[model samples]
Target chain A: MPSPLRDLREQIIRAASVAGEGHIASAFSILDILWVLYHGILRHDPGNPSDPARDRFVLSKGHASLGIYGILAQRGFFPMDELKTFASSSGRLGGHPDSRKVPGVEASTGSLGHGMPMAAGMALGLKIRESASRVVCIVGDGECNEGAVWEAALLAAHHKLGNFTCVVDFNHSGDRALMLGDLAGKFRSFGWEVTEIDGHDHAQIEAVLKPHGGDVPRAVIANTIKGRGCTDMENNPAWHHKAPKADELEAVLAQLT
Target chain B: MRRQFVTTMERQLDEDPRTVILLGDIGVFAFRNAFKKHPKRIINIGILEQATVSVAAGLAKEGFIPLFHSIAPFVVERAFEQIKVDFGYQALGGHFVTVGGSYDYAALGCSHHCPGDVGLMQAVPGMQIIVPGHPAEFDALMTQTFASGKPAYHRLSERSNREARCVTFGKAEVVQSGGGPVIVTVGPFLDRVIEAAGGSDATILYYTTLAPFDAETLRQHAGDGRILCVEPFYEGTLAASITSALRGKRIALSSMGVPRKFLTDYGHASYHDAACGLMATDIRARLDELSHV
Candidate 1:
């Protein structure tokens, strides 16, 4: 495992430990994609987070907030010290991301199936204004159960919002309830240009994050494990919402790399 | 009123560059000329009401004023969560102009009926509810609120009052004031309320905006603490605001509007009005009873 990626996982674990509550496995599932997005893909300035020409990214699956918080902090959107205040009443970082309180957060989202449609709307608005700004929305594979997700898919396709991109974190977390079979085919049938990739690969993620220059929107289905690096947490439903207790913290940290 | 809405919105599209209209596969022909002139601004965005609202919120976030047009039930009831979360929670400003509220689509049965829109919207914090009684009033309210930077619901109806009263955003207009039970009418129910209180010395207050309820106006003219509220939508919709406005005073409040139940029978709006006891004669009887009390 790469040292930087392992370090990020450690940061996520420590933050969750301090908060004593978080969707740790869920955060682990999308950490690489978020890291790649903030590092290379999204054209956002940490200092000027509300730049008119900056690209917009909406975390439709906002329960994995620890992942984005770590990335944003690493990118200097806020100080790294704020991570300790996660889920505390005194902190701006809640279990879900709030755009108003956080500098780089574009949309406030916690309830599933909201961010994609909002991203489609932002993409449509940018297209109308003839601006170069783009919008990227990430949704959990489990979140696809919502009717609003498909509604947004249809809308983005119908409007031919070329500036929009939807990334699905296919961690198979939702398989226990309902299986989303053939996601790429479903997106293609909905008129989106579909691409499937290993979500943990930084190079693979970076390649598909650029403009495709098409009339229709793009969908990247990112295949990922629920907890990628940690042995005890990987694809473990028990770890889905659990933070490490003080006694178990050392053992979990040892498994990160 | 829908015609006036089209003309008024057409003029707005021409005058304001930031104005945008998103239709839910309804009122496309009415906006044909405006679409030709500003095709990018005027869009029939299909029948997906939930997506339309989120899309409007997105546009609002980008500094563009977006108006979503559709039937009341589809716009307000079906896409309510989107309006609540996307617009209200996000603090984004947009406009929702809906038709066929109450029993306006009475012939279409329960599937198309939405009497709980105002009640539903009132639950959302910072939501502005506007029920226009006349075409001119619709035009007036739409002009003032389209760019006000708040989520405003402009509910239009097929019915209209005989004359246009002086309309304000949050303030109520006093149509007739006398030393009698205060009769407050909302939107197009003004004329019927007036007829119900004819030959009596009753105070009539007309309300267009229901969210920032004109409690001050009601408090000023709530004579003898006897108040009768006649609304075109659900009954007792204004009960909380009325009671809250005059909390300390002893008051007898009676409400007459659409009953909170499904009207299974298929008929026009007038027939439904009669079924709900909203006709002038019915209201007059209620007014008389209130006066005697």
Candidate 2:
């Protein structure tokens, strides 16, 4: 079997190849968080899709959908073979995750600034049901431009949803590398207990998540490298979604080796 | 009406823990005392309309019935994505109570006027649009909406009006039956149409159920003559429904309320008949013209 990290990288490539468009940098940046959540931390069952107690995860940064799609394919939510349908007209996958179309997808998301409140809602539901399950979300640092995100951030704390955790994939870059500014501190202003971390370190993510309970809603600002783990494409905007022509693909593949 | 809505919900919550009530800063209205009564169940979700409906959808997937309420335009227009994706895509049972069926905020002008809610909301699948005519219909619709157990948008008036006699959820309410002209009224504006027609002089068809309409009632009431419809807002409301169901079987179904084009007009009339289009005078004049044929 391919290593989980390696499998994720290939899935990202495959998903982009199928759709022919993607936020490649953001997708790669959140790869480790997606890996650690699905493989090591979150409790879920691939076999039974509707288990009430399963920990829920919302890819709130839905532009980076390939990460979640890649993990779902690996977990056998559908089949690994179905990745071929990603973002095609006849496909179950779209540019973002649509829960109605895909099994094991907790909620439909593509509209950024909208998913976290739904995540908070899911967390609220778990609490109302008196279940021990938690709700987790992966959001993008740049997507904080939306006013709705702050509303949700304030709501998450106001509700006292300690069972909910948000991980912000902070690539320190934007469509133009300028935004509303100071995203990690912005989370603090919204009353989130914030932590900044190295997103590429799987061990750091694993070590930080060992504790289950907390009093406040937590935010992990995972400082990541856009186009991470790639050699020449590491910070190149051209590779954001451009299909690496044969030579570049080979070069990218060689770095993984 | 808010009391009726929340009390009915309270009854449902007592039976099933999954029933939830979400208000978008709509506490000044009544019956949602349930929020204070049961803190876990009733949530004043503040003014964020977009997040409110998305969160409702999330709560619904967890097997809860979410009753969402707010001003007409903000609740429906602001959170359209949430409504379309969360509720419409999934067809979850959500009771969306949107106040201000028409120009209730006469002075608030364009932003507050929800001329497009019913028509827009009606286009969504499994979404039942309700324009209850009076307090009685409001109470009945509240009970029936829960019993129907489906996604619905109920547009209620901010002020109470002359109470209509009867209200059936999916069944059409036949107000004043007569042979010449049939006035199909939506929301509390039905009272104006009934009054304008000089009591039992003309037939009035009050629509408490905007969609999944009692086509049989429309077919029976709307035969071989002009049927006048009075509503608070635009052509999108019940006009499309009547058009779709009846289909080219023209009985001269002219809508009474709201301008067909962009209404740059302002001010809330105690009733919107002639000013907004659904006045009995307009209906009477139209019937006169249609009777010529």
Candidate 3:
């Protein structure tokens, strides 16, 4: 039997190939974390995507949208056939995810640094409304370069919103890899419960994301490789925005198998 | 104007449970009673403007109508991209209430002076911009804005001493009528325009809302084809909108507002208004010039 991770990678490759180009490597890096979230942690119903009591998931690092699209479809949020229309002129699946266009998407995020602030706001709102639901935001390590992310980080801690959780996909890619030294330390100083873990490990990812009943927002520093499953694409900066060509795609898929 | 905003927001909080007020650590004590009454809804997210606006966007997404408040520059200029993407692009509705229009805080220098706030918001598509002339107008527009369920920006100046007038949303109030020239006063600029007109024959069109602009009213009152626009923000912010409203009409138009340059001369709002030709006397002279043209 094919592993769900392998199946998700195939789905992403198929969609990205049709779209001509995508952040395949970026999507692959966050695949496991997203899988564990939708399958285990997140209290969301595919039938009722707009369930007020359900937990909210915002993919702040929206460049890795394929991972989310794959998971949502697999979990029956929408038809898997919709993935073929990814990045098409009239398709709902654009390069970045839009909440209004897609089901199971809590916030429309493509611009870096907006998701955490939005998630913080959602958490604050949930707290105000006395709802037990939580808000989880997935941000890229590169995306943390934005000052808005830090501003949101400070706000979440200041409010002591325990319902808010930020998962940083610390793949150490791009110029931000060199600039964002000691990422966990930065989040710790911002007053977050920092837990550095091997991102590809599903058990560890699920462990941190589950509620721990603290008076502070939690930051899970999921240390990951840029392209986790594929050997050729792993740690290759060129795969940040570039899709794998025919031969490379075959090679990557073979590795996944 | 800010007091009326707080009063209106307090009422909104009581009426609607979904209404949440988020502040950027500005006006901490101003909303003391509100904080005391509704502790859960009113949130002071420290001095983070970017997060403040983004959080409002997020709350709006989560079925909560969040009314965010801060100084004009911090709310509009500082976190403008958040407004552009989080609210505008995402199609989320949030009420952005900003104080200190133009040189309201002249003593604090250019940082507090947000002369370009309206222009900045105007640049983003789908943002309903409202500038109330009085407390009553503020109340009416605030009610209408929350009810509208659309993304909006309300620019509040420091002065609210003018008599409260019955103002409608998306409709201009014809204060004084004539045929010489149409003197359009935006928000708090009404008192100054009224003073400038001084029983003149020019038609006075006072508008509290700018985005869903009442073009039909402007056409009805602008019979002489001569119009003078007096605004409290950056010059020519509404020129494009006015031009679009009166398209294909042969008319003489002139605008009076704060110039694009920041005025280093520190004083009251009136001082900056005078220096930038945004005061009543300056408006009167411009109206005279427009009438002749």
Ranking by TM-score: 1, 3, 2
lDDT tens string, model 2, B1-293? 65555556667767767678888887545644565567798888889888788788778877878888889889888888778777887677778888765577767776877778887887788888887766667777777777465788888776556665567788877766776777677776765666577744457777778777777888777756576666677754676667666776866776656776654556556444446556557666665665566
- Which candidate leads in TM-score? 1
lDDT of 1: 0.91
Candidate 3 per-residue lDDT over residues A1-257, each given as its tens digit: 99878888888887898788789899999999999998879999999999988999999999999989999999999999899899999899988999888999888888788888999988988887778999999999889898889999888898898999999998888454457888899999999999999999999998899977777999999999888887778898767788766766676678774
Against the hidden true structure, what lDDT does model 3 obtain?
0.86
Root-mean-square deviation (CA) per prediction: 1.3, 2.9, 1.8
- Candidate 1 vs candidate 2: which has greater TM-score? 1
Model 3 lDDT per residue over B1-293, tens place: 77778888888888898888988788778889989999988988678788788899888877899888889898888899999999998878889898887889998998888888888888888889999878888889888778576889998878863698888888988999987898777887888889999867899988888988889998777785788888888878889888888888987778888888877988777677667877678788888887778
Ranking by lDDT: 1, 3, 2
The candidates score, on chain A by TM-score, as follows 0.98, 0.91, 0.96
Predictions in order: lDDT: 0.91, 0.75, 0.86
Which wins on lDDT, candidate 1 or candidate 2? Answer: 1
Q: Report iRMS (Å) of candidate 3.
A: 1.0
Candidate 3 residues lying further than 4 Å off, grouped into runs, are A174-178, A245-252
Q: Candidate 2 - CAPRI tier?
A: medium
Q: Higher DockQ: candidate 1 or 2?
A: 1
Write the residue-wise lDDT of candidate 2 on A1-257 in tens digits: 66767767866775676567777667788888888888778888989878977898989877777778888878888887777677788988777788877878888887787778888888888787877988888877777766777888888888888888888878866647566466778888888888878998988887655435865888888888888866655777777666554445656666651
